[model samples]
Target: MAHQSTHETVDARRIEVIAPNFKRRLSGVTTTIVQLVPAQRADGLEIAALGPGLPRHLPKLRYRDLWRLRRPPQARAQRVWHARRNTEMVGGLVLRDVLRMPLKLVFTSASQRHHQPFSRWLISRMDYVVSTSRKTAGYLERPSTVILHGIDLARFRPPGEKFAAKRAVGLDPNRKIVGCFGRVRRQKGTDLFVSALVEPLRANPDWIAIVAGRTTEKHTGYAAELRARIEGEGLSDRILFVGEHTDIERWYQALDLFIAPQRWEGFGLTPLEAMASGVPVIATNVGAFPELIIEGKTGIVLPDLEPSTMQEAASRLMKDDGMRAAMSSAALAHVAAHFSVAREVAELRAVYDAVSPPAETRAGNAP
Candidate 1:
């Protein structure tokens, strides 16, 4: 049973850890699994993802492998099960408690608010807990290890030529491009970004703004309202709403500045991504913004989400060429030093190693 394998699957006996993406939709949790699982595998950990929605190439176990969870991998007496969501935590609980599977349950919490009683109880049962930021950790009743998210630096490095990168993305090379990317809804503060930029774009002839993200059907009215507001300002051409983009890294490369205008977040990654692309940011004081952004050095993390504050900050940066350039350089260095994928991978290794069996104990056995 331990050695049973499915189509395009890794041998089940070899997997010492399982990362399950219980959800079918590609949410932030799925993105984390996609990005980190490969990095973990390359770090020499025998980890496989379980469930649907992951890329076919990722080493994984199908849903039918639920029964296969009955056996521990060949080398280890117990395998680690890392869960990021409530359904996943419940799945692990049923596997280990109900079915008596040999798994050590681990959960990673990224929520910045208080958890419901049931969620808190679910967390209490984990073998180890991880928080994405100190702010998130504050909301957790149990102690947790703080591990900030990191991006693929090779995929998000600075563009060689700013204007050329802008031109490549079909943007006007003459005007400075400022961007805000995420869901087009009130929750993401897309309206705040637009309101923040309207006054600046109206005053400055040299700057342009772009909002790149999908507006779901639920928020179609919100998107239309924002478009109507932009149309009212007679800045429709200057302020563009480009729909969802697959080549997001390229869009990031073309920006002179980035904005993360979220009023609330679990642990925001857009600001990190913007900084990784060597673009200075104006981010709200939410999620891990304060942790990721070095105020006045790399970027400004505003105390509030007011459009006025964002406008003034962006305007101030736009006018000062030297400050923008210095911030750009500092952003690149700060991310490289503090938030590389390598660092994230290394930190996660400690979490895995803490709960997993020692190598000497699980080395020689096989199915």
Candidate 2:
């Protein structure tokens, strides 16, 4: 389902029209529309607020709070909110009570406490709550499933000419580039990635690490720490921070290998992009890595966060051309078979069918 937001309304509406066609073809059945947009624009439509933490002005079908709210309420209203206490019971009761229709609760990522709480609450309330990672699923107090986010593989495919893309993005075409792309942050393990590079550069001084991401206070501090580490290692010339950019696929195409040594992630989207671009990835085994990188199959998974671990894995992948080629093919095939929209829709359809009410449950509302 399309996530409804002020910025995404147009795209969401477009998908609303297109989704039915997909449902008809994939499930051989008609689909029901459940609006999650807030009350200001909901126009009196019926929507069950998937979690206690409602968006700014959305009408609350039922509210439950699992994640701690980062934003305070503008003006408190006499609204019923699902309390964090005994949320599992409340969710299960609600599932059997209020929302008896087929339902699928999509949890994007857990950046806050509430998102997970809401996700757990809804997992008990619905047929299934789709998480972006196996680690995310592990965090849940209730049953949950994993569905890795897919990329527009068409847009992120290997470029026709590697040098052409590298030049378009203002990079030296001849450099053996090691690219990292994401919103720069410590939790993303930017420091660890930079520390790992220290030894690698001593062996191959010409090799460059191209780090790209937006710099917020949370991330800028981490970037500063990384820069200091690079300078201390006496490899400032080899490490370059490109900041943030919208055109990430081009960066992926230019890279020889992608490095993501994050401490935690819901499901790393950057690794998916790198995989789609057919560039091998070296990522941490924490969180979603096991699900995305199939050890010896798709890409290398580092079991530890040590710089030596990452350096060793990346060095192996870079030197073994046959291994890199095999992993590249496997990466593309894995994404195509499991992460495609077609696969997502099929899994969602099964959940919808399982939740569809029996004749006794539907009564007069039967259609």
lDDT of each: 0.90, 0.57
RMSD (Cα, Å) for all candidates, in order, is 3.8, 10.7
Q: How many clashing residue pairs are found in candidate 1?
A: 0
Off by over 4 Å in 2: 1-123, 356-367
Q: What is the lDDT of candidate 2?
A: 0.57
Work out the TM-score per prediction: 0.95, 0.67
lDDT of 1 by residue, 1-367 (tens): 5864343567676788889989998889999998998888888888889888888668887667667767777656778999999999999999999999989999999998899999999999999999999999999999999999999999999998988999998999888999999999998999999999988887888999999999899999999999999999999999999889988999999998999999888888999999999999999999899999999999999988789999999899878889989999999999999998889989987887788765664464434
Top candidate by lDDT = 1
> Which residue runs does candidate 1 get wrong by more than 4 Å?
1-8, 361-367
